[model samples]
Target: MNRIFATSICVILATSAAAAEVELSFYGGVQSAPSSDVSIRDDDSIPDGDFSIAWEGRSLEAPPYYGIRATKWRSPEFGYGLDFTHNKVYPENDELPAGYDVLEFTDGLNTLTVNAYRRWSSAFGEVSPYIGGGVGVSVPYVEVANSDSETFSYQLTGPAATWIAGASYPINDQWSVFGEYKGTFSSNTADLDTGGTLETDIVTNAVNLGLSFNF
Candidate 1:
């Protein structure tokens, strides 16, 4: 996964030389996750079981939800970029199996994606509407604890993908403000401290407000 991410960065950098404009953006927002089934495999203390998880996204709490993006525009209508998002999830304790004390990725379910974008001029009066999608990987700070063991560290889990729709209004030729809706899907399989594995597929949705600077 590290190799793939590095390769993507190289590709983005190579493409930048041909770009007509470069834009950097920063955003903060609220995010949420839907309930999903979690699978546990080959564990010593706890019996293996498939359980339903009700996820909570405490976006305003502690670490917070945020994103950064760098785009290389080839023209006014077409572009591509790299986007990094810090998203998190916490399972409702009542939903977990017995003896499981902690199960969450509160630190981050970090996603880094390389995306292609398309924008339309004057889609909403002075605002420009845009859409984008990308493929990447999830590097999450997995946090799991039980009576016999605990696992707390970042791991490269698996494939992740995202789609976004938004509109931006120019404050000036060099600056703009925007709002957007984004959705992401991540498949994670993390190692447990006791030599077991826990797996889950997560779908997250977010609404964001942001500012962008073009150079």
Candidate 2:
């Protein structure tokens, strides 16, 4: 029994050391001002509820986001790799002026992204800095209702692009804290059943902080 326990401890330590080189991180944090302007008309406007507010609004809710990354240290100075994430934009409600009975302007944007980057580190515990870009497809799901009419539903999806730059600080071999600033650019054009088209351009900026595991 003592021999087995000793072997297990050795294995665990070995795994932790290995992780210091190749890392996999999982994090969830809050990002604000990560939205665009919604123009319901010429005079009325509202801010978009991006991934930072997907689940709910007006509370102490920390928007959740998860991603996976792989890194290969080239020297003590540089490294590169790939990453992916699924993010959401919350839904909002707005009422049109009198004579118009639109119940909700509830629309959301969900996207998937792929990115590549390079890292730069210095002696102060290592700063893995990187910059890379990616493409995503934005899908918008919308629902609308009126007093005397049945509810209407529809969806729209379009392509998008993004650029990111950030750094990570190693607290230890297998654990670290990181922050990233990402910018997303996209557009949407849809024809309303009521006649005419709804067109929009979207821009989002976000910052994230959380735990990262090396290896």
Candidate 3:
């Protein structure tokens, strides 16, 4: 994870140095996930089950929800960038299956994406509205504990995607504050310690407030 993050930062810095209108932004906010179906399969050491889990975001807790982005605009109204989000989910305790004691991705359901964005000038007085969408991959820190086995590791699960709608207010020529609604979808199929697999598809929605530096 450290190596991946470091490499991403290097790429962003290199891209920013060569870009005409580049912006770096950081955000923190509340996020939530609706209930989703979960499937657990194992040939030995655990029971197999298919059930629904009510996911809790607990965004304000330790390890929180946050995001960072770097954008390079080709024109005043259009741009593309890299966006990374640290998202998490916890299943309701009562929803756990017969053999499982813990199942959650509290550290991160992390996503790194390449997004395309479009902005409109002064749609609400001094505020400019923008929208974006992207496709990426999911790297989640899986935490699963059962009666007979446990697994805790980061795994590349599958494809992930995001869409955002937001507006910004310029604080100065080189700084701005923004708020946005962002949604992400991820499909995960992860390996278990018991030589089986767990699969689920998750959708997360977030409301974020952020600051940006433009050059």
Candidate 4:
């Protein structure tokens, strides 16, 4: 039993050490802004619960999106990856007047994902296309951006689903360019911590361009 346990521990440590030696900074991608139907409200103050106090999709809009990824390829046809991304925009309640919904980073969403993929080769390894899926953690801050006023924003987290498909064309043995489609589905509700709740639905369809390197 002791010998078997030692063998297992050695195998795990060897795998971890191999991963640590790989070039970690090797991929970057850019995509269009994500789309979500997210809104939050205060139930205590607004009895009607109409457009007068809700921020619609417009609040989640931001400029083009970019992300960094760390991936490991165990073989020529398979690999695992993790992604971190940020979309800088204010989450507002568009239903209210112009000035009432100007909260920044504190109300926006942050996405962290982990996934695995299998690459298919064709044309004598000249082309590689991949399909993958993973789960994501969608976190929304609970603090408001209003300086003069006080409104707290909190979120109840839920499962986020992701799917991706892409193709890469090698420029050389060390570099390649690729394009892909990615989508996410996450449904959650934000609590104002006052008297209102925001039904936040995040469903984003995006296309992306990526540059990859093997070092």
Using TM-score as the measure, the top candidate is 3
Write down the lDDT of every candidate, Cα atoms only.
0.85, 0.47, 0.89, 0.53
**Model 1 Cα lDDT, one tens digit per residue, 130-210:** 999999999888988877778898898999999999999999989999999999999999988778898999999999999
State in Å the error of residue 75, model 3.
Answer: 0.6
Off by over 4 Å in 1: 1-20, 93-95
TM-score of each: 0.89, 0.55, 0.94, 0.63
lDDT of 3 by residue, 1-215 (tens): 45446666888888889888899999999999999999988998767889888998999998889888999988878999999888999986546766778889888988888999999865678889999999999988889887788899888999999999999999999999999999999999999987899999999999999999999
Decide which is better by TM-score, 2 or 4. Answer: 4
Cα RMSD (Å) between model 2 and the true structure? 11.3
Candidate 2 at 189: error in angstroms? 4.1
Provide the lowest-lDDT 10-residue window in model 4: 47-56
Judging by lDDT, tell me the better candidate of 1 and 3.
3
- Give one digit per residue, the lDDT tens place, for model 2 in 60-79: 23324434444545556554
lDDT of 3 at 28: 91
Structure candidate 2, residue pairs in collision: 19-214, 19-215, 22-215, 23-215
Output the better candidate (1/4) by TM-score: 1
lDDT of candidate 1 vs native?
0.85
lDDT (0-100) at residue 193 of candidate 1? 74
Clashes of each: 0, 4, 0, 9
